[model samples]
Target: MITLNSISKYYETEAGVVSALVNINLSIGESEFISIMGQSGSGKSTLMNIIGCVDRPSKGQYLIDNIDVGTLSDSNRSRLRGKLFGFVFQSYNLLPRLSAIEQVELPLLYQQIDNRKERAIQALISMGLSDRIHHTPNQLSGGEQQRVAIARSLVVNPKIILADEPTGALDTKTGLEVMRIFNELVQKQGISVIIITHESNIAEQTNRIIRISDGKIIEDTDKIVKVKA
Candidate 1:
């Protein structure tokens, strides 16, 4: 459902031009769970951003579900992102003032969808956040806050979910719980979930793992791994 051909991302650093992604070629299928693993300077985040439509590629073609993202207009790109991609972050980017329900509903505000509140409430409940519906970000625990972020992303019913270091901030136990949600989203909801992580243990659960180094894709293969949870 996603394709990238010789993709490269670059930035002008103080020292010189730095390449984030270097001539990368990748294809990810629908309903698949994949992990992008690399060290700090690797292009995992840059790759995810390009795939998620949060950022554009500096060169090469990016075809998301056969739709060439580079050719899309801003509104079309925004619509494509809303329709095809959900996003989770290292930090749960929830609004400090908005409750879980409101935060989830914020996306729909632009779509002119009816019954916004009820739909938002239902989405939160589906993510197992019903009991914490009225709580703001600070009122919830780390796991709960991340779950709220998950709910917000899923509420849009996007075809794919791109997560960047989703378990970075949480403890091991909490990180596993978050990954369990990702597993559920792929196995049950049939959403393609790609996460950028640095842990082999974490990448083991995914159907495939792609490793990047110094802006180039060094490994893209299916790995055999057990899922204890």
Candidate 2:
């Protein structure tokens, strides 16, 4: 459902042009659970940002469902982004004052969708947070807070979820629980989930693992190897 062709991203730093990603060619199919693993400053997050439409590539093409993303107008890009992707982060980026329900409802506010409260409630309930819907970020545990973030993402019914270091702040058990939730999203909901993480154990749980180093894809587990004479 998504394709990246020789995508490269560069930054104009005070020193000079710095390349964050170099010729990143990838294809992500619908409902695929994939993990991009790399060390710090290895361009994994940069790749995710480009894929999610939060940033533009300095060169090359990104297409979603045969739509060229680089050719879209800014407003059109925003519309496509909201329609196609939901995002989750390591830090639960919830407003301190907003309750779980309120946090989940924020996304619908932009779309002007009807029955916002009901939809938000259902999303929270699906995340096993029916009772905690009234609680704020501070009132929820780390896992609960992350679930709230996930619920907020799902409220949009996005086709793809781009999660950046989603389990970084949680304990081992909680991290595993979060991964289970992601797996369910893929298996049951048919959502394409692309997660960026440094942990091998976490990446192993996904169907495909892609390793990036110094702005290049060094290994892709899904690629078939050819035996040579």
Candidate 3:
């Protein structure tokens, strides 16, 4: 569903150009569950941002279902991001004042979707937060808060779920609960999942593990050896 061809990202700092990603190539298929593992400064998050359309690659091509994303206008890219991607961040990124249900409704609100409240409630329920929908972020536990974040992402029915260190803030049991929800989305809904994580145990849960170092892919467990005709 996604392809990156010879992708590179560089920043023009006072010290001169610094490469964040170099000669990266990857393919992610529909319904695939993959983990991107790398240490700090390894460019994993940079790659995720490019994949999710939050940042454009400094060079090379990014194609989503064969459409060249590099060619899209800024407005178009935003629209594409809304249509195709849902994001869950480690920080939860929730508005401090909004209730869980309200947080989940924000995405649909932006899109002007109808029956947004019902949809948001359903998403929260799906994430096992039915009883906590009326609670604000400060009122919930870390895992519950993260579940709210996941609910917000799912309310849009996005094609791909991009999670950046999704379990970084949670305890082990809670993290597993979150991963279980992700697995369900992939198995039952055919949604693709790409998670950025530094934890080996977490990476091993996914169908594929891709390891990056110094901004380059060092290993891909499920990389196809040949291009399909």
Residue 158 in candidate 1, Cα distance off native in Å:
0.8
Query: What TM-score against the true fold does each predicted structure earn?
Result: 0.94, 0.96, 0.96
lDDT of 1 by residue, 107-221 (tens): 8786667888988898888878889999999999988988888888888788888888889889999999989999998999899999999999999988899999999988777
Candidate 3, 49-161: lDDT as tens digits = 99999999999999999999999999889888987899999998999999999999998987889999899999999988999989999999999999999999989999999
Estimate, for each residue in 3-38, the C-alpha lDDT of model 2 and write its tens digit: 999999999999999999999999999889999999
True-vs-predicted CA distance for residue 151, candidate 2, Å: 0.4
Task: Report the number of clashing residue pairs per model.
Answer: 0, 0, 0
Model 3's number of clashes is 0
**Model 2: per-residue Cα lDDT at residue 137:** 95
Check candidate 2 and list the clashing pairs.
none
lDDT score for residue 17 of model 2: 94
Query: Candidate 1 vs candidate 3: which has greater lDDT?
Result: 3
List the candidate numbers ranked by TM-score, top first: 2, 3, 1
